[model samples]
Target: MEDILRQAVGVLRSMWRFRWWGLALTWVVGAAAAVVIYTMPDRYESTARVYVDTQSVLRPLMSGLAVQPNLDQQIAILSRTLITRPNVEKLINMADLNLEVTSGPQREQLVGELMSGLRIGGTGRDNLFTLAYRDGDPKRAQRVVQALMSLFVESGLVSKRQDTDTARRFIEEQIRNYEEKLTAAENRLKDFRLRNMALLDAGGRDYVGQLAAVSAQLEQARLELREAINSRDATQRQLQGEDPVLLPQMPNAAGVSIPEIDGRIDAMRKTLDALLQRYTESHPDVIGTRRVIEDLEAQKLKEIEMRREAGPGQFGSLNANPVYQQLKLVLSETEARIASLQARVGSHEARLAELRASAELLPKIDAELAQLNRDYDVHKRNYETLVQRRESANISVEMGATSGIAEFRVIDPPSLPLKPAAPNRALLMLAASVAAIGAGAALTFLISQLRPSFADGRSLREVTGLPVLGTVSLLGDPRREASERRGRYAFAGGVAGYAGAVAVVTAALKMLQG
Candidate 1:
């Protein structure tokens, strides 16, 4: 610590050796800096404060029914990115700052100046923003601030409209896509029904249920058919009571089955009669039906031959007895009904076989049907939601037009600055003086290092790395002492001159600031 203090004292002594040089340098630098500071143009700052109110009375009321925008976030982003190059150019135009710039470089320089001078500061939480611009002309600063405010307002409105338009277009496109999906789904369902029409029952049950129901129906139909056949046989048995008459004419094929050849023959004749009304006897259906009747007649004749071989008796007719005729009619009707029921049962059996064969295919069809239904429902639901949202968007936009979504209030109008806000002359002058003193000290220190002087024997010994054995004392001279005193007076006058110069420059700065 003692060595450090001694080193500092040595440096001060070195600086003191060139004290006049330092004082002269200080005066020159300080004067020059003061002049520059005084001549520097003043920058006036203009500012405008805008407060964004994101909270609206309608927001809570229309929460779910309307599409709400994030006003705070949008305003914050706008405030930050508003100072873009395009916006700067716009600002220049609005403020008439580009009228004088004829060259490309000048325009670029002006754009850069505008961007740099424009300052935006705000907090998203508060939703408050301050737009500021600095310029040499106070009126021009105010004009720039005004132009920025106008841009902010216009951008906000334009952005809101653009967002609304984009959302509407998206929703409309989705609705169109969903409509196509609905059409496709309907067509698919229609095609499925058409393809499976043969297998499907009137009841809208799955294929397994249809199979069970059809089996049950077939059993019931067969029971009825059997009952009808028995009734017809009983009627035939009653014909045996008709004086042993028409029994010889009928075929005893079995007790349960009476020969339905007569009833079939009657129905075919009726059909033939109907066909004759629509077409000539030469028609293929008439020829085929007539051929069937001839074959049946041959079978009847063969049955009679068998009956005659059993017993040699003449075939008798019971058409004379009215009771026998009535019984015969009943038997014929019953046979007809039994034949129709048999056809129904056969159809049912075939369907049941088809269902059993398609057991694996049934499940696949069912699953496919379920998937299609689910997809159709999903698309429908999404389409409905998008439609409702579109309505809500329209409502929101209308409400915004009526009540506004957000409010941009000018809390403070653009301020017209009257006084300069920059170029602190007093501070700059002080710094310049301090720097000049530092420069002089540096110059003297360098000279002292080059031509080193040892004030004491100890320093010389330290430099020499040797022990000092003795010291020499010089006698004082009156002329030399007087010369030393005069030199001290000259140094004091130089100091006074430095102080006076500093005081004069400071006075001038104060007057100019005023």
Candidate 2:
């Protein structure tokens, strides 16, 4: 520590050797620096802090809850906009700043200086932003900050209003279109019901009763036809035996009883042909008529055979045969009656079946119409509900609006600075003093280096190779150096000239600054 102190003393002593020149220069340079600092225009800075609303910063939450704007995106947008040319120019105009550049280089330099003074920063870990601007006038800086705030707020409101209006109009159009589609669907269902009356199930009233009645009539007609056909077939079998009964009595008159048996057979064959012409083979009456015709044929053959066996004598008696005559008469009359009854019954059955089919079709049509009506009613009700809601929406649109997307609020106010933030007079003066002292030291060092004499007295002896002589002191006060002292006067004059020149230059700089 002592050695360090001793080194510090040695440096100070060397520095003090030029004290006279150093002190004079220090005052002159310091005064010049002061003048320059005071003459320069004072720069004023204004700053404002704003807290960005988290609502604008958060992302839109479309589903679960209400959405908030993304804060990070808003901050980024603000950052870029803060440096935009339009914003800067507007600030300049609004603040009434008078700035000029005499040349291209000057303009460029001024731009750099302006950019350096303008600052935008954010509060740590918060959604707060700070904006600052510096100008020659304090009021201009304050006004510039205020102008930016107003512009941002107005711009945001304008953008939000436009977007909300667009969305509202689009939703209205969609609602109207849905309403039209719903109405058309309802109308279609209504028309379909009107066309299919059976859809209502109204005409199916006697469906079961009518079906049963038609079935009963069919059964009864079938039973009657079967009985007639069976009776006819039984009679035919009995009459078709090998021989027919003969009539002997009225015989005296009919010993001629077989008299016209062949003629009678011819009459019966003609009656059978007439019956066949009136009815189909499968008809109940036709089956009975056919069976009767077969019986007549068989009985006529037997009589003819009997007549041939009894010879021509009993020919007339054949018709008088009791069984043969009785058979022929009954067969012809019954066949004729059966044919008429069958024709009448068949006609009634065909007409009844047609009526029954018509009844069945009516019920089906009614059922279909009923279903269509039900569907139409449902659609119409839904359409009416939607239409009412749409009307309400329209009225609401005209009355008031509920769009609330964007809003702004002030966060922090501008502050007035307590101290001047420009020029830095004290620091400038100190710097000038240091430079002046350094210049004095440098001038002394340069003079010492240029001199012809050696700094070490022993070096001169060694170069000349001579015996040492009495030592002479090169440094001393002029009055104290008795031997000639001629070099001392010259050295003093040179130092004086240098100091005088420094004083003149320092004074000129001061005058210029003032």
Candidate 3:
């Protein structure tokens, strides 16, 4: 410990020898720091607060009527993307920042600077944004912020309108497609109906329905014709058995049964039963069957009325041969009825044959027609819907143009800064003073190591590895003592004055910054 203390004292003595040089170097470093601090440019920050009003009364009022965009999310995205490179470039143009830029690298550097320096704050849901920028020039800082604000609002408007326009264009194009499809379907259906006019009727009668009607009529007619032939054959047999000379007396007034009428009624009843098995009574075929039965009954009532009006003499004359006349009359009546039934049967048979031939082709046509009709209806519906959507889009565009979708209000406009906002020179000056002191101490320590000296005989002996018989001391001179004392006072005063100068500069800088 004693050796270490002596060695440290020896190093201090060496440092004291070069103290003036170290002090001068320290003062140079301090002055350089002060000069740099003084020359640093001041940066002024411009700030703007924007409140985005995403809510609109028109939004709810036109809910289903118009397309509503998520304005809050859109504005949030705009705020975030506002500091992008392209936008920063546009901001430069808007602020005329490119006027001084002479080269592409400078412009690129400016863009990067704007990107890094631009600041935006606040959350999407809050809809409140703060844009800030700092520049050496206050006017330029304020201009940048103002241009950014304009760009933000302009981007929102342009992007929104573009979105709406794209949607409307797509809708319009689809509408045109559906319109063409609808028209084509209509023309196909019309052509099909025109080509097969006989197969289909205005009452929606197709091949199967026509075939059914024809088959039923043919069956009924055959039945009626068979009855008429039987009646006519029976009457002819009876007339062959009876002699022409043996005139029978007039028969009693009791009326005979109209078997032919009963047979026709039975045939109609059978037809009704067949139709009922396939369709409800509400079906057109079923209704027609009931109406035919009523008509047959009405014909029977008219026959009865004619018989009563003509009297019993109408059946046969008492003076003439009653049985011969009655038999002949029955034959004639059966022949006429058979002729009418045969004609009806022939007409129905021809119709049934024609319908059956068309059945092969009719079914395909019917199915295709149904499909076409369905497709047409679907296309028509979609076309109508698209037309309505187009109208809605137009309304939205008009509304956007007139009323504005999102309202932007600047709560705090960008303003020119009155004072510098950056550099923090006071703190830098204080740091420079501390650094100067440390540099001076380091310089002295370095010099002490380079020019080593021994303070006593123990250190000298240790360095030489030899014995020191004795130590020499300078004569005790008061003049030398006083001169060393004065030198010590001067070194102390130099250090104190340097420290005081640093303190004064730091204080002055702090006042200037404020």
Best by TM-score: 1
| Local lDDT at 164 for model 1 | 94
Models sorted by TM-score, best on top: 1, 3, 2
Kindly indicate the candidate among 2 and 3 with the higher lDDT.
3
lDDT for 63 in candidate 1 is 90
Candidate 3 per-residue lDDT over residues 1-514, each given as its tens digit: 9868877778888888889878988899999999999999999999999888877778889989887778888888877777788788888999999998999999999998999999989766779989899999999999999998898888888888899989988998998899889889999989988987867746665567767777887898899989989998998898787554422324743443344454556566776787689878766556666776677778766775676577665542133256765675566556555654665576677778877887788788777777888888899999999999899899889878878878888999998899999989989998998898789888988988888877788888988999999998879899999999999899999999998999899889989989
What lDDT is reached at residue 367 by model 3?
A: 79
**Per-residue alpha-carbon lDDT of model 2 for 1-514, expressed as tens digits?**
9858755554455454444555455556655665665577767777887765544222233322332334356554665555555555555555554364456676556546555667768764565678777777777667766776665665555544564466557656665766676566667656755664432233333445445665676677667666766766766776787365454334343333333334444544665567568756665545655555566567766765676576555554443356755665555454544554465467548746665657757566556545655665665666665555555444433332343333455677665554456655545555665676577666544444444344344555665787777677667666767534655565566556655645564555445433
Which regions of candidate 2 fall more than 4 Å away from where they truly are? Answer: 1-19, 55-69, 97-114, 152-408, 415-419, 451-454, 457-514
The weakest ten consecutive residues by lDDT in model 3 span 244-253
RMSD to the true structure for each prediction, in A, is 9.5, 21.6, 11.3
**Evaluation by TM-score, superior candidate among 2 and 3:** 3
TM-score of each: 0.67, 0.38, 0.54
Choose the strongest candidate by lDDT: 3
Q: Name model 1 segments beyond 4 Å from true.
A: 1-10, 197-353, 453-504
Q: Per-residue CA lDDT of candidate 1, range 310-399, in tens?
A: 663433322336776567667656655555566557767877898899888877777777787788899889989999999999999998
TM-score of 2: 0.38
